[model samples]
Every structure is written in structure tokens, then in C-alpha cells.
Target: MQSTEQLDEIWQDRAIESIINFVRSADGDFNCIEKLANAVSDPDSLQKIVEFLSSTSQGKQAFQKRPLLGNIDLQKLHRLPTNSLGYSFANHLLTNNLQPLQRKSVENDYEFFAAHITETHDLWHIVTGCDTNILGEIQLEAFYVAQLYASRFWLALITKNLLKTVIYDIELSTTYMDAIAKGWVMAKQAKPLFGIEWNLLWETPLEDVRNSLNIILPSS
Candidate 1:
């Protein structure tokens, strides 16, 4: 747990390193992403998220209990109905080689804010119809930018990566840009996913969850 006084310095240093790695690849190294999240300090954004969560029944319970997705049972998820979000997420994890999330050290409320967002990263992908590919990763970050009120870290990554692609691979620039645009629209139209109790929804039908959240898959 880092002290409040140390947060600014720590975040700036880590943000710089995270940017360099992100330029080379959109995935941006899992560990680096965590550090970058830890570096961000936005009290207003966090307060708004807290207020949003507090306003809903499910969100209230989620905030009070602080349920973690890591506690999810992979075997049970596998046994869920094929059309269930849980089953799909379990399969997604296995197929994509994505590791279960780990908790970051929380020195204060702000750190906890960072930790919560880090933990929910994959759930966002699951709900947003994004995949684990490079394009999907960038698009997801773009979605977060819009959803989180133009998160600086997410914006920085999206801008840097888009610029890089445009400079070296101009043809692919449109594709990446399109993904970002879709993410922005998708997030804007859908419910805020941060406060969701994903564990409870595992056994529920994926379509139902999507419909409830107003999450529509982009037509191909």
C-alpha cells in the first residue's frame, strides 16, 4: 500500500513506462496495466462511480460486499447452460489463456478505486462483445474512455496506438478507428457495467444479461 503522498510520483513514473510498452503493442503487458491503473488519481470520477453504484440495489450490494470475480468457480461455470454468460466467459478464459485477476495492494480509497477497475477489466470484455485480439483490446480501452469520462490513461493509449498504426500501417488505421468508434457508441448506449454483480449473473442467460444491460453486439 503506497501512501497518498507517494501516489503522484509513482503514477507518473509508471504511466511513462506503460506508454512506451503500449506503443509497441496494444495489450500493454498485464502487469504494466495494473501499475498504470494504480497511478491514476481521479477523485471526482471515483466519487461519481461510487454514487452511481450506491443508487442501484445491485450496485449497493456490490459495493457493500465487494465481491470478487476471482472467487468464481471455473468448473461450475463450465457446467452452466451453454447460452449462459458464465459458460461463455469460462470458455473465453480457457480459449484465450487469460489468467484470473489478482488484487492489487490498496493503501487507501484511491488505490481501491484502481483495484476495482483492474479486477473488472475482463468482465467488461465479456459484456461488451470484445475479444482478446489487438483490435479488441484497443477498442475496449476506447470504450472505457467514454464510459469513465475520458480516462486519461485510456485516451493516451488509444491515441498513441492509433497514431502508430496510421504512421506505419495506414490501411489498418481505418479498422482500428472503426473499432474505437463502435466502442464509444456501444458504451454510450449501454448501462454502466462497473457496478454489476457478475457472479450472480453467471447462471443467467447471456442474452438476458445483454438485454438488461442494453449491450448489443455490433452487426458484422
Candidate 2:
């Protein structure tokens, strides 16, 4: 078996290659959302995604934030309190007896989005009441894929669901997918009808805030 160091190195290399390929595919464009959508339909369109991501305001912010974590210890991440978003996510995974994939080192603007998505995944779990189980992850992935149009992520979800169905006899992945679709629709409508900022959702309780905004939670 490969040592942890070796595995980390391998993952880092693969992640770097993926980022480079994504960037090169972009040619020289800076419209990531459109490029990403197009890339989903056409693999070669990733070049535009890379270019767009490399130039975005969010991408620049992520680039600056990454170095801050370099000096800090990652293993200490596990020691954070359960109420912390990352800790909650980790706890949820432990509660469900699921293991997370090892961290992969990434570079460049494409990597920025990767990091953002990875870190924010736990926040999604908290917001959506999704657990860390395979079924829950599949559902959350569909929601994110719909919102973000990240092709590779969507593919990963599809592969994971297929494996789960074959190995565990799961039949409810479609239900999870439907939930994501509905959630997306609700979010889109709620933003306009409720007239609340997205960031405020974190500060306020969903039910109470929804009431204030006249937004109704979909039936459980």
C-alpha cells in the first residue's frame, strides 16, 4: 500500500493536472459561469471555464485565502467544536459512518473554485438538513450541480450513486435528485419574494426568517 505521503502527492499531482487542463481549455475567456455550463455540454469548453475563473473577483479572493491555511495545521481541523460548520460536517460524516476523501493539493483559479465548493459543502449540509450519508450527499450534489453547473462534481455524484445502487441496493437516489430540483426552484423564487440577502440566511433561523419573508418550507 502507498504511504499517506505518497497518496497525498499523487492526489496533488492529479489535482494540479486537472486545474491546468481546465485552464488551458479556456483559451482566453473570463466568463466562468457560461463557460462552465458550456463545458458541461462539451468537454473542450473547459478552457473558457479556466480562463473565466482565473479572472473572477471570487477567484482572486480564494487565491489570497488559500495561503492562510498553508501555515496552519490541517489535522487540528478535526478538533474544532461541533457547532462549527466544518466540525459539524465532519461529525455528520462520523455519525453516518462515512469517510471523506483525502485532501488533494490544488493550484490556480480552477483550484480556487474547487476549494470553495469543498469547504462550502458542509454549509450546504447545514442549510439543507442533508446528512453525510451517501443518499444525502447525492441529493446535495444534485442541488449544487444545478446551481453551480460544475460538470466534474455532477459526474462524481452520478458515479457514486451508481456504485451505491449496485452495492447497497439503493433505490431512492431519484427522490434525492427530485428534492434538489425542488429546492433549487424554491430558492430561486424565495430570493425574489422574500427580498432577503443570501448571507442573512446563515444569521437567521430558516423557519423564523422564512415566516418573516413569507417563504414556506417545502413539506417534509
Candidate 3:
């Protein structure tokens, strides 16, 4: 049997290989968004996005935007209004949701991006007004799978939804595709309007931030 240390080394090697493959496969020519848009069903807006990314500098800009979590203030985040969407989402995870993978040890920039995206997932949920219930999560995942070029997001959604169907009595298979379609519509609308600066958002009080950013909250 492999020792724990040896197993960890092997796992780390595999993880590195997977990330390298993902980066090479998706963005090898640095045209991942276009590739993703083409592979999925062609929606006009998505096609427009592809054209925009392909023609303009935004795709490169997005890819170039270095991860911004290095200086986040966890304490300030905790002090935000309890009812604020970000705070509420964080609370839900702390109190009821399962623990996500630890992020501190991630060394590669690409791996860091993947982990960053996973951590901010609830922010997207809040932005989309999707709850964290089984149905809602699957729906949100489908939308994310549709929008993001990361293959892991799509795979995670598929595997998790399939497992939910088998083990949790959730019936998501038939509706997931439709939910993704709807989410794409909403995301297109929302993405253009989402303009919060990372540092300002982290420090600003939720209500003030929401008002300033024009984020609409669902009625409680």
C-alpha cells in the first residue's frame, strides 16, 4: 500500500497534470471562449460574446486580470450586515453547507483561478437570485457551465446532479437544460451590469454596496 505522503505526492502530480491539460486544451491558442461558444449550441448573444472577445481586447483582458483575492479582508467581510447577500451566503456555508476544498495551498495561477471561481460561486448565486437548495444549485450550476469555459465546472455539475438524482431524491435531469437556457438569458443581462470593484465590494456595507452597484435583492 502507498504511504500517505507518497499518495499525497501522487495526487498532487495528477492535479498538476489535470490543470496543465485543461489550460492547454481550452486556452492553448488562447481562444478558449470562442471554442466554448462554438462547441455549445449557438445562441445569438453568446455568439456576439464570442465575436466581441475574438475581435476586441476583452477576452485577453479577462484572462490577464490577475486573481484579486490576495488582500481580501476577512474581518471586514464578517462585519457586513447579516442580511446582506454576501454575508448571508457566507453564513449559509458556515452553518449548513459542506466545506469546500482548502485554497491556501494552491500554488499555480490556473489552479488559483479555478479555486477562486469556486469560492465566489455563491456570489454568482446571489447575483442571479438563486437559492442554495438542491434544485436551485443545480440550476445555477447549469448556467455557470454554459457561461464559463472551464470544463471542470460542467463536469462537476453533471456528476453532482447525477448523484443528487440517485441519492437525494432530486429530479433535475429533465429540467437542467431548460434551467441553463433561462440562466443564459439572465446572465447576459446581469453580466453587463455587474461592475463591482473587488476591493470596494469587500469593504463596503452590503446595503450601500447593493444600492451603489444597482444589485436588486429578492424580497425576504
How high is each candidate's TM-score?
0.78, 0.45, 0.50
| TM-score between model 2 and native | 0.45
Each candidate: what lDDT?
A: 0.73, 0.47, 0.49
What C-alpha lDDT, on a 0 to 100 scale, does residue 51 get in candidate 3? 43
By lDDT, highest first, what's the ranking? 1, 3, 2
| Among all candidates shown, the one with the greatest lDDT | 1
RMSD in order of candidates:
4.3, 12.7, 11.8
- Off-target runs (Cα >4 Å) in candidate 1 are 1-21, 24-28, 31-35, 38-64, 104-108
Residues 54-134, candidate 3, lDDT per residue (tens digit)? 343533343345343344434455567776654654565566644433355455434444455555666666656677665
> So what's the TM-score on candidate 1?
0.78
Clashing pairs for model 1 are none
lDDT of 3 at 58: 36
lDDT of 2 by residue, 194-214 (tens): 111233233344445445534
Q: Write the per-residue lDDT of candidate 1 for residues 50-140, one digit (tens) a residue.
A: 6755676866665666656557677778888999988988888787777657583555444554666777777788888887787888779
Segments of candidate 2 deviating more than 4 angstroms: 1-60, 63-106, 159-174, 186-218
**Residue 184 of model 2, lDDT score:** 59
